[model samples]
Target: MAFFCQTDSYATELLTEVVSCSPAQLKTENGGKKETLSGYNVILKDTVLFPEGGGQPDDRGLIGEVPVHRVTRQGPEAVHFVSSLLDPGSEVLVKVDWNRRFDHMQQHSGQHLITAIADSLYGYKTTSWELGRQRSFIELDTPTMTTEQAEAIEQLVNQKIRQRVPVIVRVITTDDPEFNQVRSRGLPDDHAGPVRIIDIEGVDANMCCGTHVANLSDLQVIKILGTEKGKKNKTNLIFLAGERVLKYAARSYSVEKSLTALLKNGPEEHIEAVEKLQKSVKTLQKNNLTLLRDLAVLTAQSFKNSPDRSKIFSLHRKEGDNEFMNIIANEIGTEDTIVFLTVGDEKTSGLFLLAGPPEIIDQVGPRAAKILDGKGAGKKGRFQGKANKMSQRGEVESLLQGVLNGTAPKEE
Candidate 1:
């Protein structure tokens, strides 16, 4: 049923009678796993806790010393999901989490103010709005918004906040003449009875059921962060209101300070210094790759003078890339020589490569990949694939050696 929060937005606690309480099960996901939790659905005669509605999240708090995890509205009843069931017809103390409630109030009210300003000044209708935990967004009908336009809207909204205008809530019948004057997304088809209208003094009057502060000054400030292109021709404007704006500013300042210290540059020069460092790192990486290629060639040359030069050579390199292995294989491969190479770190997965005579690869490539639990194809005497089970590297090397020595069953 309708509650005190619908009319009085500032109410944080209410002592009400429990209408009903029933056992319920809640299914939730945690860390990619689905879990079923046991709880009870407790309905109160009147509640201060606001149910999740109209893009705003539900309020969380305690009911008679038991934690209320979720509050949802079913028809006119507010359902409180708690761990233990309360007796029907018993009185309970309902407390709303003030921090969460106030944050929501600021963001939701800020959205209405911004939306009204956008429509009034630029004729941009708000298509949708989302009240997020730390940030909020309103999707506009327009495809793009200029930086200057956004700044103007921010300035205008903050000006209203400075005026400290009263935010009044009024309830009126559906047939009331003033109903037509109030702006709204429009009433639901099934909605009946009185309509709650929120009026910002000398600013806007809209039909909304969400809780809001008594005055615009309670919002403290509003910041329009940026905008992104949304679906079709819509533009999503990101913003932070009230204490969230302060929190974001503090976090950003801390990050900037750390970045400046680490980069050994002032705030304005940090970006330039980081760009230069990145370029130097890229150059060093390229040089290091060249050195690795040269080292691979030298390693291949060292094996050239080996007295036991077999037709099939199996090499295991713990510190080299696929390119390095390929270079070594290309340098040492002959018409009859088959080189089986694997390279990777001990802690993670590795790569496998088979290169040499086309006939040998065609016979052994697929078989090797299958044994290593990997997938690949061979063409023009080269086959390469990833080895999923890195810990089996030693076994893979032994299997290759066995195949080469004729101790293991050879591929047909």
Candidate 2:
């Protein structure tokens, strides 16, 4: 059935009777997250709220005093999911979210314009389209479009908008001659209403059930942002229409201003400035790694040169990484002294490594890692893996100490 929206896209409010109301399971969005809800499924005699269909989304509005979060098509009825139940025989004000309604209207009709123009000029049939939150895209059967071709298409679309072409909806039955004339992908098996043909005056007409603007001028302007690769070797033509174009322009200018301040350069030179900054960052990182290596060597030497010459060495660096830890372990000589090296926050997650004799590393490495709430693997007397709780390093030190003292416990 053709809902009120398909018939009059501009109508924002209607006084309608609640035909039926029943308890049902529902989903409502809270702060952009969906939650399962227990609510009333209200069937209104008539509604301005459009159900989600035809690649367009459902409408959000009010049914009397209750907020209608969801509306869906069930056969010929538009089901309004609401928090409060309205009496079956009572009349209620069904108000459409006009801003959202008009935005969808603009994009849905804008799609028609794009589809018609693309097909007429390049014989590129629109396979499908999506009305995304940020931008909309229509997938064309063609593989690609050149810069010149895309420009020509966008030029023609805006030209038609400038011409202020009237967009008229025609309702026709199966027996009507125009029924066979309009372009259609095909109708649903359950489609029960007269076919809708949206005619863009002197442009084109196609069979569609979605809501649209009354005129091309209502679209304001359509900006074909660019094209992207699509599945099946098709091309998706991305675009923004009406207020979206204005919004995008405003956001882009804002970003440019912020970049100019942060980069200390005009928009024209921002790219070069960013490139130079990136190169400088890379050089600094290289120098930092070299310093870490030098520190690792000196630390290992401190252990070797000490009078005690400790057999079990334990070290943790909050700023170091796996590479730094490995360098220290390698310099200490894994043949005799057992080295336990960790790099990261002492009380949180980080990497760990163990180095010692073949038999000792096999036994102590995995045990030490487990004690530190971690895991590891060993080969040629070297074992390393990640640890979640670096706070247990002391327990691991005691375990290694027991091994050095020949008092380690037997494997379980």
Candidate that would win on TM-score: 2
User: Which residue pairs does candidate 2 place in steric collision?
Assistant: none
| Model 2 agreement with the true structure over 11-51: per-residue lDDT tens digits | 99988899999998886688999889988899988899999
Give the residue spans of candidate 2 off by over 4 A: 27-35, 357-383, 398-412
TM-score of each: 0.88, 0.89
Candidate 2 global Cα RMSD: 2.8
Clash numbers, per candidate: 1, 0
Q: Could you tell me which 10 consecutive residues in candidate 2 have the lowest summed lDDT?
A: 185-194
Estimate the TM-score for candidate 2: 0.89
lDDT values for all models: 0.86, 0.90
Q: How well is each residue in 1-412 modelled by candidate 1, as lDDT tens digits?
A: 2578776778889999999989998777889999888989998988999988767898999998999988887877788898897999998888899999999999999999999999988999998899987899999999999999999999999999999989998888988999988888876665667888889988889888788888999999999999999988999999999999999999999999999889878999988998999999999999989998999898788777788887767777787788998898888865777788888855356888888778667777787787777787879999998877666656656765676677867556
